[model samples]
Target: MVDTATNRVALVTGGSGGIGRVVSERLARDGMAVAVHYAGNEAGADEVVGGIASAGGRAMTVGGDVADERAMAEAFDAVEQGFGGVDVVVHTAGRMVLGPLTDFDLDDLDGMIRTNIRGTFVVDQLAARRVREGGAIVNFSSSVVKLAMPTYAPYAATKGAVDAVGLILARELRGRDITVNAVAPGPTATPLFLDGKDEETIGHLSKMAPLERLGTPDDVAEAVAFLAGPARWVNGQVVYANGGIV
Candidate 1:
């Protein structure tokens, strides 16, 4: 066992991009020493770390494939060696390959399952071991699971698995005072959403929400920060951070 301290340490998987980047920055800004983990985007991870540093916060980037257990272990090890025991883990690493279920390829489905469901289990297990008492674990899910939108079957299947895993993990950590929760974000305007779509398509989708706009990284980050900080009473729940998109 490592010596426990009061200062908080947060490890954010997928911290190099999208909502992961925003969450890492928000947590760091809130005075937590952050571990920014990226899968393949080292430069992007460095950029996030630099931004945090320039903002007078401490952070470092560690890269690994979240689907690999050994890699996740080393990533957690780096965080512990650099800061201390982890106090929070926000799992935002995910991949999506969308198509109608009738035409969806099994290979693509397998890939999605491996990255989203299996990867979350691996990360959460490591987090359960590494995080200290009073720690928080925030897992990412998609509001599509609730909306059951078409062409999102495979993706939502994985998130549905995530929801189940996260809820069970929360109860499993009951005596440890660690809270595990999942955030389901809808129509976030991240690179993941904007990388290929035309403006017209994006606009049409944005209007589907009651807020009548796409969500932002900062919007999702705020939810993560809440779960990581003063939301100790909030446990085992899948909170939708979407702008009433469901």
Candidate 2:
């Protein structure tokens, strides 16, 4: 068991499922007291927390809409109250609406902007203020930003905003010893990615990487663990976890 003497705390948004779930569990295994944040899936969040506790790690669940500033502030407060103070925050909450730019529903665009863009702002704003010195903040972007996939325009636009926010926030933190970075994963084997994709499409995307397979949630989690823990020198950048896709 890793020693918990350092008292590191982490808040993982969307920690109930997909990439966020693995990230939460990995951080817990690293000895951080984790606040698993979920927007609606209480059962899923509880399952993650339970798994951590079963493995002799400490964790709890926090729930709220990621884009709601007040709700997120409360979520931060809850983590602070539970684990002393937050040391790391991984904002994995996001939405993806795929369609050609000209044909995309305006409402779908609006939702993505709110969840992916505004949500990052809200979470990072509080993380900037609350995360302790020597801490880290990781936001999620997407390899699609570089892949420039046809229907991914709307989703990629939001992640493009995330990339910008992460870069600027790292510089803004200055001497605070907080590293800000974004992790962009490509064609990961998550429920979100597999939801609408057919076998042929999935196989094509899996083979896009030189690795010749879809990334696992654990694969992306390892990247997040590095950024959240010992990667003090890696700041203000996007670490693409896409297996050499770009």
Instruction: Indicate which candidate wins on lDDT.
Output: 2
Q: Considering summed lDDT, which 10 consecutive residues are worst modelled in model 1?
A: 1-10
After TM-score superposition, what is the CA distance of residue 171 in candidate 1 from its true location, in Å? 0.7
Candidate-wise lDDT, in order: 0.92, 0.93
Question: Candidate 2's residue-wise lDDT over 22-124, tens digit each?
Answer: 9999998888889999999999999999999999999999999999999999999999898888899999999988999987899999999999999999999
Q: What is the C-alpha lDDT profile of model 1 across 8-103, one tens digit per residue?
A: 899999999889999999999888989999999999999999999999999999989999999999999999999967999999999999999998
Report lDDT (Cα) of residue 182, candidate 1: 95
Model 2, residue 169: distance off in Å is 0.5
Q: TM-scores for all candidates?
A: 0.96, 0.97
